[model samples]
Target: MDGKTLVRRTNFTRIIAACAFIFATAASAGPTVKTLRVDVLYWSMNIPGQVAMRKGLEQEAAAINRDADKKNQPRIELTPYIAGDGSAGIERQIAQMFEAVKRKPDIIIVQPTDNAALAAPLRAANQAGIPVVAYDQYISGGTLAAFVTSDNYQAGYLDGEYLAAHFPDSKELKLILVEYPHVSSTVERANGLLDALRDYRQPFRILKTYEAVEPNSGARAGAQMLRDFPATGSVDAVFSVNDGGGLNIVEALANAGRTEIVVASIDGDPKSVDNIRAKRLTHIDAAQFCGPLGAEAMKIAYALATGKKVAPHHLVPVFPITSETLQLYPGWGGPIPPRFAKPWQARVPYWEGTVRPAK
Candidate 1:
């Protein structure tokens, strides 16, 4: 070949080599390291279940990062915000939700203070293309990418069933109900308890229903309940919505010398379980898998933000704990007990649904 033709062939080879170099660089680059901003908003840090849940979520995030590092994947950055105090916590949470939207976070995990109160802000967040995960308390009116909570209805049913079995011989069982109506979980729990009682073959009467909003208000409500129903009255048992309220109710009963009254409630709080082990007035507590609830929510949120398939609703399992079963439970603040036999042996399973599609 001529010198000019040789030069042309050399230049063509160089061009092909350059293209190959570009292709190799692109192929070896792998996926881009993505940064996901997650806002974790809680109604109140004072709530034991919420506190445990928050801890679980933090641990989950750390675990996710560690695993991602090992597998050469992206990491998550969480921004946590707590409502100032319980008294005005709901309003503060709403404000925080709006602020989070302004900051444009990729996802939000929240434990709503009220079922309907947080709806508007959460709906707005959905409209802005941000996914929201409801943890602990269910938001009745918002669009949630996923909801993670214990089977509150089942817990209440179990508590009521225990009460029925204990008082089977009584012809007319008089019971006091302590409930918090604002929260969806509490509402479901209350309804479940009542329904279980209704389904009981024996006759019963609801002596009174005191609105003990939460554990914080338990003392006052418990005290009032004691005053309203004298020890000489026909009060057989008390079904409180949660362990917090149940503890206060038990205290009031003790103070009023009304130790004969049996108490059943939700939340497998450690203190409450200890009371059972010690043979206190509180008989049964529905133990929630609190930490697992949070951890599960975190996992679902991560899948959702990453465009992976996730269940729209996730129900953590719960079981009943009494004096006989206290030793078998691991309490509500952690995962299911390794050695304890699960009473309700089936999982609710995850269901598919979008948080809320755009209008």
Candidate 2:
């Protein structure tokens, strides 16, 4: 071959080899994903929020993974523990909390069964340098990396407003308040209802504040209360802290052939919406955005787990749902109402810190 042709061939081979070396180095330097282990302790699968939280967590994890793929960041891996229904399950929930802590997961997200029962285990988790994210309900004495929940107090307050505006006409308003004080969320709800009731122009007395936590217990209490006040004319209105208790009250009143009582409550359970649609005694339900609450908790947990700065408290908003307004409401275990538009006003107070000062 000619000398010039030989030189060109040698140069071409050297350039090809250099290109191969560059490609190999680039492939070897590809991004690494940081995987985190997240432990979730659900109070009860029967409760809507608890179950919805699981769904929301999965969604949030997917979003996080997608974003992580784009930015090449960490991905979350969740391990969930569900405690079943009723008062009988409280002990089991506590046991599950301790068990989760022992596993030493990087982050623990909990919907506490009782305000006090889960505190110890949560404290232990914190002591071990594991961040705890409280969802739906707060743990009174634990160190939390973040707290995410519905604006429960606002939920009850909104319910009370709905009842007060459309409250039944009675010589003297006799209201029955169904409450369960073991959890902070319920207590706030009860207080919010009372706060709104206090603004009412009419004279009203709380006939009784029955301690019923869930629907079954609420039903039992409602039945007993009805028996005690069997006259069918006693309670002018009923304010239950959650939808479960409100449903119980409706059932008790219906069986007794009384349709005079107006029921207002929190938790937008699908059954409660159906009752409203059926023109039952239930009047209003303050719908909590449970999916959003769960999603926010997942976000906060991810931030805490990854050593990022986050707010001490993150609150999901709530809105009032009535038979008239039901068509526009969106909540858990139900389809988004017909022409649902985002409730900008409901979100403003929470986002702008206007409501935080009141709490």
Candidate 3:
């Protein structure tokens, strides 16, 4: 062969070898590791259910980061902001959400403080292409990627049903309410309780409605209720929207030696359950799977981040803890309890919340 031809062939061989080397390098390089920064904004930290929920989010996020293969999915970085611990906490939550929007996180998971206040900021986030997951409470005006919360209405209904069953013989049961109407969950509970009483064919007069869903206000409400209905047979029962305030109200009533007024409340708080066991004023408490609610919110966010389709709403079932059903409860950190016992069965499946698309 000619020398020039031999040199051309050698150069061609070198080019082929270079192409093979490039291909091998590209093949060995794995998928990029991604990080999803999540901003979690909640109304208050003083509540047990809220605290348990945040813990659940952290736990589930950690598990997602560790269990997921790095090459396949993204790691989660959670940033949490809590509103101040008082009635004025809603104002702080509004400010924090504005800040969260400014920061432009991959996602925002929030438990709204005031139902209608977040409408504007949430809409702003949507306009900016950021997705949101809401749990425990509904924020009124904005479109959400997903929402997860306890079946609050059913919880209240169950509490009301329990109260109605106890006072079966009375033609008209007189009840007072310890309620906070600021958020959808609490409001739903109040409505549920009233509806249950109505459905049971047990007529009731809402003798008084006092506003409070926490300890201090609850105690005040309880004290006032006692004074208002000073007579022994004036008030037959009281329904508290949550155990946070309900428990305190019961203490006040019990201390005042007003044991005749039976109480029904929501939130499967340990103290409330103990009250039931000790036969205190709290006869039936509707328990939320608080931890699972938070975990479900995180799981929904993760699904959205990874391009997986998810339902727009998720509803977790609540458990009713009377002294009879207390043994089935696994407390705030575990997943929701399965179907057990009649009449207290789920209103909707644990995974069955769906918000239909607009026409």
For model 2 the local lDDT of residue 226 reads: 82
TM-score for each of the candidates: 0.85, 0.84, 0.87
Best by lDDT: 3
State the RMSD for candidate 2: 5.8
- Between candidates 1 and 3, the one scoring higher on lDDT is 3
Tell me each candidate's RMSD, in Å, in order: 6.2, 5.8, 4.9
Model 1 residue runs over 4 Å out of place are: 1-31, 84-87, 337-359
**Model 2 ranges with Cα > 4 A deviation:** 1-27, 168-171, 333-359
Model 3 vs. true fold: TM: 0.87
lDDT of each: 0.78, 0.77, 0.82
* Cand. 2 TM to true fold: 0.84
Identify the candidate with maximal TM-score.
3
Candidate 1 lDDT tens digits, 1-359: 99999999999999999999988998898767888899989776666767788888888899998998888776899999998545488888889999998899999999888888789988899889999998878786768888888888877877776776677645688988888888889988988887776776647888888877456588888778867877565698888888766777777787787878888888877877877887788888887877777888898888888899876777777767877666566665554644443343223222211122212
- Deviating ranges (above 4 Å) for candidate 3: 1-29, 69-71, 343-359
**What is the full ranking by TM-score, best candidate first?**
3, 1, 2
Give the alpha carbon lDDT tens digit for every residue of 112-223 in model 3: 9888988988998999889988888888997999888888987898887777677764578888888888899999999999888887778888888998877778788878
